[model samples]
Target: MTTSSPPHDLLPLAGDFDPRTRQDWTALVADVLNKRRAEGDRLAPDAAAEALVTALDGGLGTEGLYLREDRPLGVPGAMPFTRGRVVRDGTVPWDVRQLHDDPDAARTRAAVLDDLEHGVTSVWVHVGEDGLAATDLATVLADVHLDLAPVVVSSTTDQPGAARALLDVVGDRPTAGGNLGLDPVGAALRTGTTPDLGPLAELVREAGAHDGWRAVTVDARVLHDAGASEVDALAVAVATGIAYLRHLEAAGIDPVDAFGHVEFRVSATADQFLTAAVLRALRRVWARVGEALGVAETDRGARTHAVTSLRMATREDPFVNVLRGTLATFGASIGDADAITVLPHDTVAGLPERFSRRLARNTQILLAAESNVGRVTDPGGGSWYLESLTDEVAEHVWTRFQEVERAGGVLAALEAGLLREWVDTAVAERDRLVATRQRPITGVSTFPNLADTAAERRPRVALTTTDAAFAPRRDAAAFEALRDRARTLERAAVTVRTIGAQRDFGARQGFVANLLAAGGIATTDDTTATAVLASSRAQYGEHGRAAVEELRAAGAERVLVAGRAAELGDAADLVDGEVFDGMDVAAFLGDLLDRLGAPAEGDPR
Candidate 1:
């Protein structure tokens, strides 16, 4: 059939579409039609394609590429746990669990009471070699209202003594809800001895065979707190749980009945998204496990216990850890964890001071009461970014879980060093970031007032073993010499100082300059030679930048920046350029000098 020209073809178009001058190339009919024409021939080069080719050839150096591909994210609450389990009916925030790890029963009891008074709804009594004993269980549970509160206990073994003691304390109290952790996988990981899974399975069967008690599959907080990523932590946890379930099933317990008694104790880190995503992904994977065992999907969810991670806490900035714990608490709660325990901010320093404990309890209280963080379920739902991140994390974890399974499940993975290697890689990356200050820690890395710490306070008990346990015990003089060396180095370090009303800005810049100087630059060693600039304005800008440039010109490889908020913007730029994002500043400077044909360092020409 013959076709007539369109009315638009009869009129002249106005805008230019030429490569040289086109305002909108999309309107060019030839270019648009040429796409189809070129389909049978060859494709034309574009900036993106050229860039990709150049990158591939190592010409125009770039980091990576984006390829659009879709992978299956199992339905929410489905197998392999790609998305999440438990589509929220509404926001039913996770239970609040505070830890009572005191070796002394009376002290632990006091801590438990204190936790209860501060809006804590659950208590986790740790009974490791360093934790409380079964003998202390009674006093720990005494006077605490049991109707609504739940307690969880962890030990190195599923020894009958620990379980019998715990069960005896909670006997006949309608509200006496708690789990005696029988995590053989975790026990094995910590103690270097594989547990007799037969006893563990029997314990599970016994717990499930009864009522108001549980034998949990404890993953423990050690993995995450020891530097494992969310993906590794959750994957290992799921694998461990599955390993337990298999053992139980083989022991003639129903598969569905097997998982019903297990509980997970995971670490809650400062990475909020990661923590939340780990829980969500865990639920999904667990649901699949339940399905594999012929359990109804609706009844597949397991109780999750979260504890504040010790790995990220710093002995230097003890109080600032309060903020990290708060974030972790909120993340764990929102992640639908059944319970959460926020470690005292100063717990890393040994014992938590009363003030530190108060701060720790207050953090959770503020999140739950004042912030009302517990009122919403899946609070992160429907967010494109969070959802996408949740998917990515779930997929990553699922892949890792499969790898673990292929290696004969979680315990086998650990035994074969797969899990340790995974954790070590992540730990190395995190340590590198911390060392470089790419991830700035507020009080510890940035500020220095090491001697300004308050009076010492001991914790009810130490959860972590000291270096003395691993290393040979040193005599008093040897220890003193080590301390003296540290003190000497601290005194020899460069310090930056910026003057003027712009105190905060200058302080931050000085912080960055000092960090650089510590990294090998020969800046002024005097505390006064630290980068310091005086400015009238309350903001940071070119004046600050110019000051930094002048400092650099004056052989001040590291200069402290000081300024007000007005000067902060400029100081931030300088730090960002010289320290944080500027990984190749030295090379760039050398290139500039070479381009100018300036004499190289130590050149005699």
Candidate 2:
């Protein structure tokens, strides 16, 4: 005979542990804070609570804890719809949109069919520069059922022609959904060309007679790819949308009708919380824009397509991207995104294989089916933390949007190079964090898997960044550069000259070894090495300095210190540089490579 416990009481679970209150938690945190703070500069109760605040761009930030007072409420399918656009009662959650960019027409056709046959709801094909050509659209979509599987096309150099080509294929197909992908502004930003909305306006007007097709997709992903903050993306997307609205209006299309024609494609990063908040904010602010333009409240909700971040993909340990994609998809699902696309894990290295593409689409399927992540409506609505963050993001976005309008909107800002400045600033801060390892890019900057082998793929057409066009970038490029150089150069003889026993020097020795491994270099204990790094702040400080100097005098070409160089006092001049947390690892490794003849005598920088 078994006894059932109380259904919702704490007594059963708290059999041994004592119950704790907010005060108890605060007190414990206070103890830790006081220990870390300087003596006599201790934080008071109020300041202690705020000490864990995390700063974000545009003065938006998050605190360690949010309280009841911070809560702001909203319902699903309501005006200023921060919760969601629709209230679902066990309905299909979101569209699983997968991207295909293979240049081969036959391969793309096979992949597109495979994706649609196995849980994928929509196809996002990239046409032009390095992607499928315009002539190949017919072949790629030959077997795809236009009524069942929606196809959206994006292009850089082959814009209006590509849009027309897709339309020709769709012809008079009933229930054909998806976009013509005539994002003139986005194409201009990507290809450094002047935007002409005449074709887009014409498409929107002509497609109005049809049932399920949109004209333009105002892709805000360009902003994120170019290293803009969420605030920048929100502001710029609004500005671009309005710009399109006015252009379409000038060409005799109503604002309300134009609203239905444009869709937004935004970036969803691995930071799930921030990603959710930003997406919510995008919906909220876009609703306000529609209201300002005299559109009905119900039609104001922005249709958003969330694509998992391309910038977060790593080249070396590509497997880590599985987790990244999963987190991004979770964020998009909870954030009430209409559709999502997950770029394959090995995307940064080259073209993704069939296995990579399968994993990408299945990521969304597992979350939707097994996890039931989308069963709940507005999962973040009740949480004080998410609500506060959403409000903050929305407010900041409005401020920036107003600023952009004052500067004559998105086109003018691009012309004035103001958008470039914003992207540059955000990129600088992001780069600084990665350089210092404060951001800690797993498998690249921190805890890297040195023995992992790179998966080889066919050579892909390289994408580039310029002052005129927003471009894609990877954070691991710096460390990867070091690794590339190390691969080409002769392996260095790196020895750790330990000053103390295991208890003292072991930690620093391990740290030094890890740092070397990041550059694809190894370490040894051989005293007669090309380079030696003195490890530990052993009790025999002077003796340690003398030993390093002796090694350098005997035959060592380069000598570095595991600890701070200043710690050696008079012998500081003998050491080359210091290796420690927050040090410029790139510059250190680059200089070392130069010393080791990395360029191999003839290659130009």
Candidate 3:
């Protein structure tokens, strides 16, 4: 029978209540009173009386990621289109843009072709020692049908020759399109070289001179990856974009034309919600920039392209990198990016192996074809949570952008080391959290075994740092020591086999619970006939023995332990029926409901 305590017994009333109440009404009253008192004392007393009046007066509200009554971005699709989407018939799903940095020309060409064949539509050719050189450029780009696939070329130097070279192969083709990027500021900041601002501004004009040509204004992702927060990255990007516009305006291009030709490449990290919000906020911030330049909002949304950031990619357990990439890809698509890039999982080390690149491409294919993620237009559009966060972040970015403007634009801010200082603060905070494991990386910080001996092919970049030697240090010694200690505690632990129609079912549940308990086997309630849900702590030595004895008494036999196929000894034996391993949740749930005589035949939701 269901047992619930009396409402009055849950808290104490001002007067007396019956002691025989089953719902703990008295305790409820006490809790309510305590919470009310705590909340009353917690808020600032000075702002209390007039808070509602001020809120009604539009003192506070949402702006992209910030709130207010006055809208700066304008309504969706309307000119100065900052408040919403601009495409007349909804945005085209963001393209699956992958990066290829293989030094081998033929191999890199084949890799790019493979991604295109597999449904990826855009590619970014990395700059520096790892990227294609003018010598290897032709061979690497020879068979590239730009009409079928767009290419984004990035270089460390301000020289647009390589991009120009790549573009020459497809020369002014109507269907051939992409961004020409040479971040002099980013390169100078990275290499401590004097930025050639004049030539760089010239390249913007020269590239935009071609129809369908997008000359990138900022690659602020470098700062974000190097340890800048969303606000810092957005602020720098906005300031940089403004500086570029002014520079172009002085170079004889109208500010409107400058904004149209320039696209801001942003970071789409692991924080899915944040990624979505930041992308939306990016459009708003840029819209505000346009408004400041006296341009309409609708024209602004047409100019942004969001690139998924690879900075959050971890070298450890490279597979987890796939999950992060998928999430980032989805976030970008939902956030309405014109294009998105999914970095290979092993990108942190060096150039990705063919296997990693294939996995990355297939991930997008599965999401678009199988998962149908592409079918939805702006999946996060009108989401309250996303809208609120977007407004908050936009406001934060707006404030910081203003600060940079006050510091005399991006170039001046960087010259004054203001940008660097802000980036340093973000990096320091990330480093601090990572050190304490408060922001732990799964296979990196929790468990690392140097001798695992699994051959891993990683991305190759010329850049190196002393921090790479031991940063994000995993506790190998502690892992082994804990494993050793577990051996002694085995007497209390019980191995459980949870049977389910789907193989991953029990394993996922068991893993979640075991992780929550820190260690020890925890089984799911889904078994053949009976169910078991016990905490890891509850299954200690003597307690485990008693629990097992009780299970034995309850008539359980031939228990199938739920775990990865790698961990399971006899996967075939466990698959006694039509049990699918790692089956889709929708299909699995459909089957489960059908068996319960409440079939889910419509809408699937």
Over 4 Å off, model 3:
1-75, 79-85, 88-92, 172-174, 447-455, 458-461, 464-605
Name the top TM-score candidate: 2
In the range 1-605, model 1's lDDT, one tens digit per residue, is: 99997666544454555433222322343354456554566334343243233110001122223233355544544454333344533343556677666677887788888878867777778775667788878988796887777777777533555676766776665755678777766765655566567677666655654466688746745566556666777788888888887887788877777777888878777777667766776776677677777787666776677777776676553666788888788777667676777888767556565566677767876777678876666676555544555666667777888999999777677768887787667766655555545555555444434444433666444334332111111111121222233343322234343433445455454544544332222234443432333333344466556666665566543444433443366465565222234243223222322322433245475
Name the lDDT value of residue 463 in candidate 1: 33
- Stretches of model 2 off by over 4 angstroms after superposition: 1-28, 36-38, 70-72, 89-91, 463-467, 549-555, 564-571, 598-605
TM-score of 3: 0.65
lDDT for 131 (candidate 3): 67
> What TM-score against the true fold does each predicted structure earn?
0.68, 0.92, 0.65
lDDT of candidate 3 over 130-170, digit per residue (tens):
46665676677667787767777777642467656655755
Model 1 alpha-carbon drift over 4 Å, by segment:
1-92, 157-160, 447-455, 459-485, 488-509, 512-605
Question: Each model's C-alpha lDDT?
Answer: 0.60, 0.80, 0.58
> Higher lDDT: candidate 2 or 3?
2
Candidate 2 global CA lDDT score: 0.80
TM-score ranking from best candidate downward: 2, 1, 3
TM-score of 1: 0.68
Alpha-carbon shift of residue 243 in model 3 (angstroms): 1.1
How much is the lDDT of residue 308 in candidate 2? 91
Give per-residue CA lDDT, model 2, range 1-605, as digits (tens): 99997687455766789876667767777788899788898877667777787887666898877767644476887788888877744456888899988898888899988988988989888888778888899999998888888888988777777787888888888755878887777877776668777677787876676788888888888778878888998789888998999998888888988988878898898988888998899999988888888888888888889999988888888899999999999998889888989989888877788899999999989998888887888787878888889889999999989888888888888888888888899999988877777777888777777777478987677554355777776777788887888778765547776665667678878877877767766677666566777776543367766777777777666677777545545444556657475687767767767766543324373
